[model samples]
Target: MAHVDSIRKDMVILEKSEFANLRTENEKMKIELDQVKQQLVNETYRIRADSKLAINLERSRVRVTDMFTDQEKQLMETTTEFTRKDTQTKSIISETSNKIDTEIAYLKTLMESNVLETVCNLAASVFTCLQ
Candidate 1:
């Protein structure tokens, strides 16, 4: 009977020790789980912030693209207007040049006829003196 009581006391001690170990392990696991939860929260916040920044950058890019498109359109219109004006100026210059050429041709013909008449008159005067 005494031996049986001693065995029962040893079993109780072993069971208490096992319970203490389990409690310690449970506490460590709880601490680890808390750390994991904190990390998840931090990661979520970082992801949300990154998404917001990406959205803002995309909006800015679109706005800048629109502005560039508008500027390009305006530049094209201005270039077209200048090209039309240049063509008109060239036409005016061409007309003026043609008129000047016509006047120059007429003057050249008149000068040639006058020179021929003067030469004939001089010849006639020389012949008269010789006779």
Candidate 2:
């Protein structure tokens, strides 16, 4: 009967040790689960921020494209206007040059005619005075 009592006491101590080990394992599992949950939350936040940044970048690209298109159109208009003005200026210069040439030719002919008439009159007066 004394031996049976000793065996029973040993069994109680073994059972208590097993229960403490199980409690420690449960605490470790809880800590691991909390860490996993925090990692999931951080990953989700990063994904959301990346998505927003992508959307903003796309919007900015569209705006820049629109501005570039508008600038291209304005440049084309300005170039066309300058070409038209250049053509108009060239035409006016050509007409003015033609008029100036014509005026110079007329003045040269008039001067030659006047010099010939004066020489002819001087010769006739000299002949009359000698007679």
Candidate 3:
């Protein structure tokens, strides 16, 4: 009977030690779970930031493209206007040159006619005086 009592006391002590070990293992497992949760949160934030950066970059590219297109349009308009003005100036110069040539020809004809009349009048006067 005494041996049976001693055996029961030993069994109780063994059970208490097992319970303590289980509690310690549970605490370690909880700490590991918390670390995993924090890592997951950090990773989620990083992904969100990367997505926002990509969106901003796309917007910037679109804006730059629009500005370049506008500039190109303005350049083309300026070139067309300059070309039109140059053509008009060339036409005016050609017309002015033609008018000057015509005026010079008319002046030469008038001078020749005057010289011939003067020679005929001088010859008639000389013939009358001799008679």
RMSD of each: 55.1, 56.3, 58.2
Between candidates 2 and 3, name the one with more favorable TM-score: 2
Model 2 clash count equals 0
Q: Clashes per prediction? A: 0, 0, 0
How does residue 59 of candidate 2 score in lDDT? 61
For residues 100-123, write the lDDT of model 3, one tens digit per residue: 466546645654664465456556
Q: Write the per-residue lDDT of candidate 1 for residues 24-94, one digit (tens) a residue.
A: 66567557656655665565566556655655666677767775666556556655655665566567556
lDDT of 2 by residue, 1-131 (tens): 35544754665566556556755665675576556556655655665566556556656777677656665565566556556655665575566556656755664575466457545655766686689
Could you tell me which 10 consecutive residues in candidate 2 have the lowest summed lDDT?
A: 1-10
TM-score of each: 0.42, 0.47, 0.46
Residue 100 CA error for candidate 1 (Å)? Answer: 2.7
Provide the lDDT at 53 for model 1. 64
- Report model 3's TM-score to 2 decimal places: 0.46
